[model samples]
Target: MNPRFTNKRVLLTGGASGIGRATAERFAAEGARLAIGDIDVTGANAVAAELGGVAFAYDARDPAAAPQLVEQAVAALGGIDILLNVAGIMTWGRFEETSPESWQRTLEINLSGPFYLTQAAIPHLKQCKGNIVSVASAGGMHPVYGTSAYGISKAGVIAMTQSASLEFARFGVRVNAVAPGGVATPMHEKSTAGRGVDPAIFAEAAGRNMPKLTDRQACTPEEVAAAIAYLASNEARFATGTVLVLDGGQVTG
Candidate 1:
């Protein structure tokens, strides 16, 4: 193993599953000292135990939780060299069809959580000249028929990444993001399961969301994780305020 991050301290959110879980594994394999944060305490603890890292319960909807997670992570790992924001959710609905409650919840977790986490971690990150990598979505860049809340939230993330990069550049803290298209993750099944929305609506949308060049319609969590890892790595040292779009030509098409 290259172990590019040997001894690097990392604090990652959404580490319980999907892109977050894959990102945690990637960082651990690269020899990072990780602190996994997630709402799924059991799953977060499991991942942490397997990787010999610490775990903290984190709910993205709770504004106060971000600072606490950062504090706990800094305490656990000494200081943070990388802050990976991979926790997010997507709810399916057109603008009018979406509920106010659903919209608020989506924004809280997908947008506000990262906002709060970044603010809390900036001081520590500045001390280490650390980098930040967030998982954004191509939906933020392109027009999808039925994902207003998710799209808007992700758009805010992209804006946040860029804005932070500009402000933090003098401090030597790099901020970048990976905007992936649809990914094969549990969020697809879990996000809309109980809602009255028809699952076929998502299916039809997925069909139309295909990449122009690649045969695959969606990326795997590990694939997105790889992009996240790259952005966080020294290999991408010169990159900041950059969004590496990993949609396999979906947007360009």
Candidate 2:
């Protein structure tokens, strides 16, 4: 209705649920044409249909899937004007309990996925002078116990955001990332539920991780999506190489 993104072509990974799903809805409401890519084709299709957009099955764990997802999205949307990289996973375990496999999978999804997808989209984005917004985590900023791999991976994403911004500025493509603390998303639910880790424990840790002046509270996916929209909008044209932390002010004082 706002038409902020009227006729703008967008490609989003992890669009099946959580922040990604919320983002798709927000972008659609703002009048953007979308190509939703998710590992879950059923959910992706559902969101895409609801938004009058197309969907693609995307498995960020697979290195090859990045280029293919981009190709499919380009074919469906004509060209990419905005890329939202929200596809990621959580691997919770102590250092001793964490496996090499777990590290690989987490990194592949949370770190490698964004890297490869951004690399693949750079050319298309350069042509359109588009921008990117990635979903990092509060864990990336400060270690969240029991999620070393997830934290490391997300930290990598945060770094990649700034690095890419510097490299792509000359091409007129902006890169930014959001670092959110705990959110009431499926991923958070799955990570905490019946896992022997008390929910309050994370909340407490999240609170302690932030500046003493700040408090901890779980935000909704839609709330995070709103931030992504701003960074990708014309409003943030002068902003780049920035990591926006939306963790109830935990990351900052």
Best lDDT among the predictions, by candidate number: 1
- What number of backbone clashes does candidate 2 have, counting pairs of residues 3 or more apart or in separate chains? 0
How do all models score by TM-score? Answer: 0.94, 0.92
Candidate 2, residue 83: how far the Cα is off, in Å? 0.8
Q: What is the lDDT of residue 220 in candidate 1?
A: 85
Candidate 2 global TM-score: 0.92
lDDT of 2 by residue, 117-205 (tens): 99999999999999999999988988777678888999999999999999999999999999988788888887546354546545554
- Give the alpha carbon lDDT tens digit for every residue of 69-168 in model 1: 9999999999999999999887778888888999999999999999999999999999989999998899899857688888999999999999999999
lDDT of 1 at 99: 89
Please provide the root mean square deviation of candidate 1 (C-alpha atoms, Å).
2.0
Off by over 4 Å in 1: 189-196, 199-206
